[model samples]
Target: MIRGQCLITNKDDQYNDPDVAVILGSDKNPTCESQSVLMAPKIKLSSGYDMPILGFGTYNLNGYQCLTAIHSAVESGYRHFDTAFNHENERQIGEALRTQIQMGNVSRENIFLTTKLWNIHHDPRDVRRICEHQLNLLGFEYIDLYLMQFPVGYRHMCDEILTPINDISVLTTDVDYVDTWRAMEELVKLGLVRSIGLSNFNMEQIQRIIQCSSSKPVVNQIEIWPGFMQKDLVDYCRYNGIVVTAFAPLGQPNREKHTPIYFFSEGMKRLVKKYKRSAAQIVLRYLVDYGVIPIPKAGNPLHIKENLKIFDFKLEEIDIRALRGIKSKERLVQYENIKNHKFYPFERED
Candidate 1:
């Protein structure tokens, strides 16, 4: 028998009981699962706030695409949702959550909902507006966790023209990142948001934030796949009591145009057959083995169900080592630039 204490999510009840755990949400039917696939651990936030490990990802989804995927995610037993105003799918996401709750699929309290403040909203004042708008549009009374999308931001000050005499230096004057986090921290204090976090930050940046802020970041969500996995970062966060959330947990959709998945490559694919699992399963299992929470997105009910099938099996130590050895460390989605924005904040060796 698995020795750890286990608890199930109770949507009708607040997680006042420290013994209770939150289940992660992904694509799957909450009511059905193979007997072998044990139910997920109690889901809750890193700050000891309620959160589900198997949450839904809303990046790059829109219109009916966003709606249907969210519908399937809810059906698939997902109670945690990760979305943002930039995604522009908040209305659909809100509607889906409300509809499912009304139909008795889940209670509002059972869900761990997260939304982000885009880079453009870096001003402390703008952060409040953006977060409040997200809450209103998504129709959630309060957001569980709110993250600052990135550390970089700028105002309307024009510095494109460089003149020796004028000496226009690129100094930050808009909403400083530190200011934004303070605002997010205020949200937590006000109970408008349960916890606060960072997304797309490197080690140096995270440390900087921790050094200057009154509120510590509880979670750090970033891209993680075998190809681009950041093991050191994940381990560091765990040691520091910060939960790491893996986005683009599978090879990102940008790489869907490529050949075999990183997990399905000759080395790992053979392991999949050995383990009797799919390539996606191998990748997800790899993440879980590392103690990182993965948010993989898919709309197909079958795919959603397949993802939830993970709890049934455990990867062997040797197999886990072998998967770790397959290292291309490829980042499938690094921003070159968005709109007219010209900046890159990732460590890449090309």
Candidate 2:
């Protein structure tokens, strides 16, 4: 096993970094200050911690690829990271951060790392143990944001704790999400985590957590894009002082195979030509204008830089409206297997 801060991976397997440094602002954009690099802007959470408006999402990234992506994100000036225990890459993410610190590329204090408690580990008695296990895997003292990945709680098998199985037959715990939230509140008091939040929860679930907990969830990470805006949920979270985070910010990458192309809507194309930015950047900026943080994942050097460039440009009010006009019923990341679970949150017809 890799010990301390050292990474255990083959040198030949390392991800390629082009070593090209783009200033925060290109000369063509006179409105941008050329002196500053294009790092993501931070927004203050209800918990009083500052979270970057854009973060690198480490979902489905693993092993050397995970390490490489993490390194590239840090090198590209990304300070916030979003990962989950269920993603199964916390060790690689942690190793990458430790490697970068060792190389003087970045420091721990400067990075905002987030991970979640898996549904199986939501048992109140096992919450601390789960958090400690994540800390050990991450090799960090405290996680910046710790979230309950889902409202569904399962009875974790002792033998399967180390190797989590994804079968529905595994019985669920007698625990409820509110009890889990109470236990999560204790995690904050213990100094193991800086902030606590929810993911994949609907309005009622979030409200329940808010009402029951001593420490409120500062942010809610959900699947949001132009098509499946979840406008009502977003508005509710805003009205309630909870920040909204968009996962799959660019829509599901492979969605084109099953759905019609919505990326290049006539309105989006117009904005792309007017602003000289990618369609992806325009959509991300759209969410940002609505006070939502988008965590778009990418490992390529150019793609990573392109995703960060959204902050340098502002979409006019007219353009924002035009882009928001595009509509469809495309909701990705639906956990249909657990829809019957008592805590499943997407049941509302609204």
lDDT of 1 by residue, 43-101 (tens): 44557775655567887777887787777776666666898766778889998888877
- Per-residue lDDT over 109-226 for candidate 2, one digit per residue giving the tens place of the 0 to 100 score: 7688999998888779889998999999999999999999988886677624633446644455557899989998899999999999999999988888878777678999999987
CA shift of 44, model 2, Å: 1.1
Runs in model 1 lying further than 4 Å from the true structure: 1-39, 43-46, 154-174, 253-261, 338-344, 348-350
C-alpha lDDT values of all predictions: 0.69, 0.78
TM-score of each: 0.81, 0.85
- Give candidate 2's TM-score: 0.85
Q: For model 1, state the Cα shift of residue 13 in Å.
A: 27
Candidate 2: give the clashing pairs: 24-38, 155-172, 155-173
